[model samples]
Target chain A: MGIVSPGFSGRRRSGSELPPGQYLTRDFPVLSAGPTPHIRTEHWEFTVTTETGEATKWDWAALLALPADEITKDIHCVTRWSKLETNWKGVSLDTLLADVETSADYALVHSYGGYTTNVPMDDLLDGQAWIAYEYDGEPIDPEHGGPARLLVPHLYFWKSAKWVRGLVLSDNQDLGFWETAGYHEYGDPWKEQRYAGD
Target chain B: MTTDASYLDGNAAAGALSQVFAMDVTAAITQCNGCGQTGVFAESHVYVNAPGLVARCSGCDGVLLRVVTTPSDVYLDLRGLTYLRLPNP
Candidate 1:
């Protein structure tokens, strides 16, 4: 809230629409931690694994066959870029979990590239999230987490793990790939909780 | 392409690094503390996709540098490097 200092001096900001210190990047920047895994839609599957190890799976076609919703939302990244009014289409998690059973209170979202992030189980339900496969009316690009990515717009974009392959329900919370390194456990952008202590 | 599509050389970090160092930090020679491999900072395997910018040693894949810029903070970690010698520019 102080006058723009040295660290943030490099980036531009308007503050009216963005969460805290974020800047609006017209171009969606690709920030990846590892090599991209080439996954075919035919080979893509999403699994929901409970703490008891019970699993329910859905293949690409089956997923598309389920009810889908068109969404327009803003996404904020921990690295400080926010894209607004992005459109996405995907099946709601409420519908996906309708048939699945779980007593766990936490969920650890995992991506195909070995990336994992944790969130409260409640965050995935009641219209809070989706397994988004389409962006801007087109099939989402593989590099953008296509086949599908978990879209949890309320949290930082990283929590919406790209190449999302599964959600592991847990009775206990666990720190994921970035969380273990220092990212906030529950990345609420409005609160500006970007790091461990923040 | 999203920055996620590829890993770039450390030179890609210039604009971001400019926030901290007055000179071009990517031109400095660095030695990895983990594997002891030495190279110009530009040659490190730099992954720009993530919560931050992560540069890893080309030799052993140890993290050579990590830069995370928040709204009000900039975290630069060189723990993976034993030393960095700035080239006379």
Candidate 2:
């Protein structure tokens, strides 16, 4: 006699498919802490600033001009919902950071409406992350982080900042908004690292 | 105060808070102690990415409520808010 939500399929995956304390959801729930900031594509810009203050910027057209890749990945949120096989199209972070040379170890991501998050520089390089603008072959809705959002599927969804605008390379680690407020500095969903302690 | 990318407003916490609070907590008006600003809880910033659900003052980014749920107990801290005016049911 387990309580199930209205549309829950009652289907269970093998132990390896889902992480501990997580449930699979067919719907992609929209969760945001504040009002959705509507940014026009014409007014959008993405910047990458180095520790020394050197910054390189890409406008909306410039960003779209870059080579894009189609990615299908599983995303797990700390709130206990895991959505698998999500599709997205975007420019890889590797392509964005390629020309920029830096010895920094951390990346502080900034969003359009003043939101910020920090991630290890290594985690965003290689084929690990991207600045996604399209979902399921359509332009992403503003409510779901439109113009472009950081997509890092390896860690918890929170590590993937929404409405991303810039990335600041830092030599030392600094906690972002949630990190300073007691969320785990590194949100690894597989280990259930939801809070600072565990 | 710096904005958090991993957070949503108080309205987002209504679903989680409903487990403890019977009524709609988002519609409740709250006064912040730090800035003495009054606003609906639905507009306050909420960070659910952590172990607990934290609702912050939209005016000053102060923690207005913190709810932590463990296996045995649910702890709620509302020290940052001077008062919360709940609607009559």
Candidate 3:
């Protein structure tokens, strides 16, 4: 008969198995606005404005009524925990941008909790990004950022801002919260952009 | 030379609570002065010699605590009994 449990495995099994390295948790207070010129989505609307001036605005209910798709992927946090097989459902950013006609050179992704990330027009238009509304097959909990969030799976988790509300096509790229706080501007998980230098 | 009296709700160590979001250890023990009793604080944790701050007591809701760094551990006295942030294992 084959042995059930291996004695020489030398692996500690438990319900809570932490990922490699120490995980540090910070009590980050959510900020809703910044000194820079920006718009707040709580009172404002996400208007898909075009260079030709045709535009359509989406409110909370109208935004939720859009199509939803499920995705499973690994998420690498800037704090260094790479969670595998996370599932989320939301509208694709590519589909949203397709509805707009933009000649702007760049775009700024605006989010609640007073966060913003900049992307080149080409970069924004190329990725498999989504505005996630559900997590793990249910409505995302408030603590995990409810209402809506931006999921940029290609980059570190911090780039996936919580309570995300709008996207503004601009002619320039601006840095967001962690980006201004010594975090890498382009947080690519493949390159291990966990910090400014690493 | 210290008494081992404890509180019911860990009120003395009220300033040493740490939030256990994922796998963190929360509600560490602390010494209380009021009731002359101490108990396990459920909300506080301490950071030893971190940049800009010496120690933080999450039990007291992000209050700064006294720093007494030793070779083995960082000792923080909540009321009278010491709360130690042990070295990472």
Q: How accurately is candidate 2 docked according to DockQ?
A: 0.11
> What are the Cα lDDT values of the candidates?
0.84, 0.82, 0.51
What's model 3's overall lDDT? 0.51
Off by over 4 Å in 1: A1-15, B1-5, B9-44, B55-89
* Residue A24 CA displacement from its true place in model 1, Å: 2.3
Clashing pairs in 2: A32-B8, A33-B7, A33-B8, A33-B9, A34-B9
lDDT of 3 by residue, A1-198 (tens): 344321122333331433344243333222221111122335535555443556667776666778656766556565555565567887776777776767876656665534567555665555457778788888865445566777777677667766666766655556654454455678776776555556
Better of 1 and 2 by DockQ: 1
lDDT per residue (tens digit) for residues A78-130 in model 1: 88899877789998999999988788999999888667899898888988899
**What's model 2's lDDT at B30?**
93
Candidate 2 residues lying further than 4 Å off, grouped into runs, are A1-16, B1-89
Candidate 1 docking category?
A: incorrect
Q: Give the clashing residue pairs of candidate 1, or none.
A: A30-B3, A30-B4, A31-B49, A31-B50, A32-B49
Q: In candidate 3 chain A, what residue range of length 10 has the lowest lDDT sum?
A: A29-38
Which one wins by lDDT: 1 or 3? 1
| TM-score, one value per model | 0.73, 0.73, 0.52
Give the range where candidate 2 chain A is weakest over 10 consecutive residues by summed lDDT.
A1-10
